[model samples]
Target: MLSSRHLIFMEVARLLSFTKASQTLFISQSAISKHIKSLEYFYKTGLFERHGNHISLTKTGQALYDKLLEASQLQESLHQEIQQLNETFRPPTKLAIGASTTISLYVLPSVLSAYLRQYPNLQINVLNRNSNNIQNALLAHEIDVGIVEGLTQVNTLTYTPFMTDDVLAVCSGKSPLRGRALVVADLPTIPVALRENGSGTLAVIDDELDKRGIPVASLPVLIRLGGTEALKNFVLADTCLAFLPKRAILKELAAGELVEVPIQDLTLQRTFYFIQRKGTESNQLVNTFIQFTKRHYSNRE
Candidate 1:
């Protein structure tokens, strides 16, 4: 078993902030410092380097933290195996997951429900933000795992493909573009509604459009909305067109409330990824949740 001092050191290293680690571990900042000091004394090396207000892990600290993480994983696995052998009641565990707007709203609700049913003692918290914010939260250790639209190319993060999603051009059925085949040239002529900046949907759409030699900035956007449902409602109430994930509009598309306006040779496909900090692959709870989520979607197919 890892010592309490080691656990405290890991938390502080992960967050790189004594105050944050203290709040997380429910201990006073002074107490956190004392434990870290004790660990450093035992190892006969400085574990953290301080620059006035900021703190960062030293080389020895990083190495120790990595080893402790491996040990923690082994401990958790052993505990799980023992529990399985005895069929005993397990203590409640919390898993915090951060996801982009689309996945949070359209994708994860059913999966989370099923997961809770299978593991009733587990508590799950879902943080719904745009892709950029989710990536930031993961780096800051604010969440255990993250699901986002595209790969955030930070070397410290690991991205696992969650699923592929298609963003479709759709407008209200009353719009004149209903049944009209649009070409690349016609995109700039139409009034478009778009997701706000820093949005994963917007970023993907912009990248695809740029590849086609027609930048999204060249299009005549009528309004920028924050949420998917907000933009969908705007499209329904107005005569403008918008790009939305197919999963978000299935009911409306089936009911004829919206019509898909297929542009000639324009397909917007983006892959959603499950992201976590490097070396967290050994986390059993996160691995189990990811597999369960993938299975939930695969079973439907």
Candidate 2:
């Protein structure tokens, strides 16, 4: 457990706003200020430098903040170790996961079903969001684990390669474009539906397109949607083409409700990763689920 003053300082330092920290801690801004003043008096130095409404940590404050983060990690590690050594301790009863849209809607349902059967008493919660939001949730400690597309350079988190996914260009079976493969040059003429700006699907599509000198902005976009299912439904009901994960549309493709529109030189593929805070990799429940998921997918291949 952290001291009250240290806890207040940590929240203020992380947010860099006394008002925001107060709201996060469910306290008043004046209370936050009082704690910070006391910390400064104890340390015999200012922790933050204020320029108008903006505040930044002093060098000593940064050092203390870093140490506190390390201490938090250490405390968690010690708790896990104690649990391992105690024979009478019950296993963790809850798990929270955050995943991007595609993984949440398509890939995880069967895996989670099997996992729950194995651990009948464990409760699971899933948060479905775009890739960018999933990463933010992990950093904010809102989820115990996150699985998302692509890797980022956040040093406080650890990413492990989980699987590869392919994105396909597909259109409605009844559309005029069905069975007609296209060249990259033809894309400018056909209206396309895309995922929203922060989506991993959009990011992967744009990256592959850029490598071929075709910027996504150069294409004619008919609409932008927020999730994999919404894009798929739009493509099903409308004539616009879309790029979607292969795992997401296996049934639609199999039923001939959707047809793949192969582009002459374009193939969009990306890796999905398991994300966790750097210090929590040894967490038994998370690791168990990860290994089980790997085995589940492996057997399908």
Candidate 3:
């Protein structure tokens, strides 16, 4: 178990705000300050440098935080193991997972249902957010795991490949591009319905287009939808063309509501990753679920 001072230090380091830490811990600001002061005095070094409203970690603080993170993980792992042994039936564990919109709708439900059947005592909470928000949730220790696509450069997070999905260029059957093989340059002439700015799908599409020297701004975008389902509905009703995850609109395509047109110069393959903070040890339930996901997806791949 971590000391109260150490826990406070960790929270402060993670959030970089005394007020935010206080709100998260349900403690007063002065109490947070006192805990930090005690921790700094014990270590005989300063942990944070405050400038106006902003605070940054010092070098010594960074080193201490890394060590404390390892220690906390070990302690939690030992506690969980002991709890598991003590409960003959099964120890209850809570696992909070964050996921982007497309994955939450199309992918995670089946996996989570299978996991729950095996580990009946485990309580799983899934938070659906955009890719960037999911990353932020993982950093804040608000979720045990995260699944996202694109923008994978997180030093503190460990990513393992879970699945690969392709983004398809699709339009209503009535659209002019419905049966035509379109090129990347042809995107600018089509009336496009795009996903919102922070969406992983949109980010990947923008990045791929940028690589081909085509700017996203040049596209004739009709409307920006918040989720894949919304975008699919927009395309189904309107003449707007959309770049959507292939898996997300499989039913629509099969039913002939939408037509998938291959893009010549665009390779819009996106990989989903299972993400967790580096140096943290997962509880037994989390470990089991992760193993189950790997086995299930591996066989499919």
Candidate 4:
């Protein structure tokens, strides 16, 4: 059983409202106040500062809240594991995953099918969003694990390399530049499409171009779309080129629907990473899935 005082304090800290915490925990407002008061008396310091209608945690309160938040998460994870172990007969193991657009669309679907075959008892939920949003989801504890193509690191998150993605410039099969190699100087002449800002593809593109004495904004950008599929569609309908993951355009390349445009003296690459909140690697479900993904990609290499 969880300590009532600790649980009540955590709820109040999370919600920043005694009234809301009481509603959430299905207790009386007076009871909530009583528990908080007792905790403050023991700690000998104020945990929350109350205004007319709102409340906020003090520095000491924030530190205690962080610790208690981790403890709550551990408690939930522990209960899940124990239940799984107790009912080996038909254990329900759930794994919720958050993924960026590139990994969710081009990479993980195939991997998940095989994973499910091996652990049919496991239930998996996937949330596909932009790389930045995926990181936010992990930080918010909305998902168990995340896979993203973005290389930006959050200090409180861990990024483990899952696979390498080759990003290539491509155009429709009918484009004049089809199957042609171009010099860096020629990049300025061609009309180009780019992913939306803050995208992993755009990030890598920016990095590579910056190293070559060019800025992405200096390029002849025809359009900027929010996702790979939109950019691919726009490119196929017009005489524009885009940098995309090879995996994303493999079928198109193989079928001759799109052609890779070679850039001399430059190769753009980004790694897809497994992401999790710091200290979450010790979680059983997270550890299992991370190890599985790493082994799968390592064997392919």
Model 4 stretches with alpha carbons more than 4 Å out: 1-72, 80-91, 298-301
Query: What tens-digit string does per-residue lDDT give for candidate 3 at 219-259?
Result: 99889988888889999998878999998988988999999
Q: lDDT by residue for model 4 over 1-301, one digit each (tens)?
A: 4588997888788668988888867999999988888988999999999898999999989998888877867775876678678855454566879987787886678778878998898888898877877788788766889988856699999888788889999999999988688977788788999988768889899998888888898899988998788888898888788898887888989998889888899898888889888877778767887888777756766
Candidate 2 lDDT over residue span 224-286, tens digit each: 999999899999999888999998999999999999999998889988899998878888778
Candidate 1, 73-187: lDDT as tens digits? 6776776667668878485576889999889998899899999999999988798988888999988767889999884478999999989999999999999889999998899
How displaced is residue 161 in candidate 3, in Å?
1.2
lDDT to native, each model: 0.89, 0.88, 0.84, 0.83
TM-score between candidate 1 and the true structure: 0.74
Spell out the clash pairs found in candidate 4. Answer: none
In model 3, what are the clashing residue pairs, if there are any? none
TM accuracy, model 2: 0.75
Instruction: Give the TM-score of each candidate.
Output: 0.74, 0.75, 0.74, 0.74
Off by over 4 Å in 2: 1-79
How big is the positional error of residue 43 in model 1, measured in Å on the Cα after superposition?
21
